[model samples]
Target: MYKTKRTVFIFLILLISLIVLTACNKASSSSGDEETSKEDTKEASTEPVELTIAARAGSMADALTEVVKQYEEETGNKVNVNAMPYDNLKETVVLDVRNNSGAFDLVMIDDPWMPEFAEGELLTNLDSYFPDGLASDFVQKSAALGKVPYETGSTYAVPFIGNVQMFFYRNDLVEKYDIDAPQTWDDVLAFAETIKDEEQETFGYALRGQRGNPIVSNYLPLFWAYGGTVLDENMKPQVNTEAGVKAMEMYMKLKETGPKGVETFDSDQIATSLTQGQVAMTIAWPSWVSEVDNKENSNVVGKVNFSAVPSQESDAAAMIGNWLLGIPRTSQNTDAAAAFLEWVTSAETQKEMTILGAGAPTRVSVYEDPELVEQYRHFPAQLEALQNSVARPRTSKWSQVEDTWGMYLSQILAGQLDIQEGLDKANEELEGILAK
Candidate 1:
């Protein structure tokens, strides 16, 4: 009986040992399976994604194409770029987003168009992706263009190209005439008159006066400098104020020293006149900086200088015309699009893009990069101007308002209407527009 009891006890011990061993093995296997599941999920999240980008045609499109090539090669992703004219690109994006079509993952926008897109709820609010908000390294004014409610609301885009209006002048002439760097509109006029009289081949100034957006753009700096406001506190049109008339009169005087058909001039004419040594002074976008020094294109290489627009009643307010990149709300690849935005706007990528002769950079670091500043001599001045830039009116009806204002301003420039008459008419039309 004692032998039987000892054998039974030993059997029970073996049984207990086997049960515990099985439970340990099962727990280990379960843990391993969970880890495998997590790994699979992570891999799926990072899998290669195909994306589509809609970009403005011209140099912007070319630069983006080259950058996309590098991105695809590095990340094993595919990107199809659809480059079109500005109007067509805007229309396409609006249609796609309005229809909820997952067509364009990314789109390039002019800064002025932000209000329209934001008000329509067409863009994705990027606040979540950028929880900490935009980095301080971005030009604050340029970054503000991406925010809704004109710099106080959630971000909808990122400033991709830093294009601000810069004052360009023939430094050689300024020195020749012993003129100081212009500090006010009055000084610019005096200096311009001197240059026009002294220089036989060159006009004193060049301006964009073509009817629609061009004329309004050329006039805003002067308008704001004279304490003119496009709209009052109640959103009423103030284009016919005393300040507006004075600014228009000043604009007319500047035109007197320009080319004979200055009333019909546009960006191309303005840039060409300056680069070919035909204009002594002008306000132009940063894109023209390269041509001013390029031997192949410029006749006044190393003779031009850039600065912030001159002040009058108010301080200098360079008109900001930055191009922005945004993810469409209908984009099926939001994560991939956001990734591309962060990558492109980075200092490294912007530096690369600058080397390719892309648009002006939006990052402070890129503008201050030693190599870039050396290549683009206007970089420091450009950075200064961007930091002090001002945006156009932030209203969904800005297009209509600008169109009407331009028409009247063009008529005034063409001598078809006096300053007061044109401004009054513009204000009347603008009031009608905002009412709608």
Candidate 2:
């Protein structure tokens, strides 16, 4: 059966290759499924289609490459991967899909992005394509990201990367300064003030000051903590109100302890600022654990403790950073993608990847895997964060909403616009986007 499928897949790839689109200067995409199709044995005279698998570069990409190679070797099909710089992945996939470029056969997309892709009909739906029905093994939370709201509708993507924000702090500093681990926004403010008074060199925390995703992601926990939200349950923009104001006010307070040029700092800057001992605490992804303890890069090796991002006025709010995979409507081989996806997301593969610290699993079982637990000390805390994590609003206008918010955030952090004005302008723009 497996051989038959492989033979059929290879044949389909050949057929698609005959209708050459353009010079294939191959670039892999992130969770952007191209138009896919299927044909029978009789209509099989075309050249094989090469698949471009796109994802972020780093340990994550390296891990994916290993698995991808295994797939290629098992089948005679070639799968070329494009490992993008994290900053470029978002724009690359979105732009390509919008143009219907079909540059990427399989893309690893950010979970927040699924709404944009699915709603626009840019991605291939998994339900009608996966012949055996959707696999039951995918983790529920991760699976939920790809879900269409009504009637167990078709999923546009499947989860691959399971990421969540975790809070990290210097345990020694927490103890020495007689500071309590922050329990809420109020606690964080008080702690930052205390750190300012006691340790001039090390502020209480590091906040992403850069514009776009960085700054916005940094503020979400605070926004939720103050009971302000960008949208209500009905998906309307409501970010310029009382709760929003309170959250913005608190966000500015964080600037006190953050790096000097925080307004320009992205993930790299914030991570460098915190792990190198510039600040006492920071909210970061799990990947930071490796950076902090690498002795070669960190001065404060072996001194950090990781936990769920602290909460007050609200429980801890971790941003869920998940990636989803799915077949595209333009694909000439749904069967191949389905087989490959099932093989890739299987329990054994997830375990191997997590153990290697490649891609963390969405499955609960992998969280308790002994080797993974040993390697990643805060696995339990990470899982807790994942469970309590907040997903960005899922409307077709999210891209524009993020653009406006990101721009306003830059202005606010730069003090070019006061928090209220910036937020007010953002809300207005977001509403316009939704109304449009």
Best by lDDT: 1
Residue 426 lDDT in model 2? 90
**Residues 1-436, model 2: lDDT tens digits:** 9999999999999878864533242322221223122343423523344677668787877787777777777775667778999789878877776776767777787777676677667777677656554565555666778777522566777778788888887888778877777777777778777777788678777888777778888888878777777898777788888877888888888887666877888888877877678787788888888888887889788788888887766677878888777665555555666667777777788877776667478777788788778878878888788877787887767767877888897898789998889888998888788887
RMSD of 2: 14.5
Q: What is the lDDT of residue 87 in candidate 1?
A: 79
Q: In candidate 1, which residue pairs clash? A: none
Candidate 1: C-alpha lDDT: 0.91
Taking the tens digit of each residue's C-alpha lDDT, what string does model 1 give over 10-50? 99999999999999999999999999999998998889999
**Model 1 regions more than 4 Å off:** 1-39
| Model 2 Cα shift for residue 429 (angstroms) | 2.2
Error of 1 at 193 (Å): 1.2
TM-score of each: 0.91, 0.81
Q: Please report, in order, the local distance difference test score of every candidate based on alpha carbons.
A: 0.91, 0.75
199 Cα displacement, candidate 2 (Å): 2.0
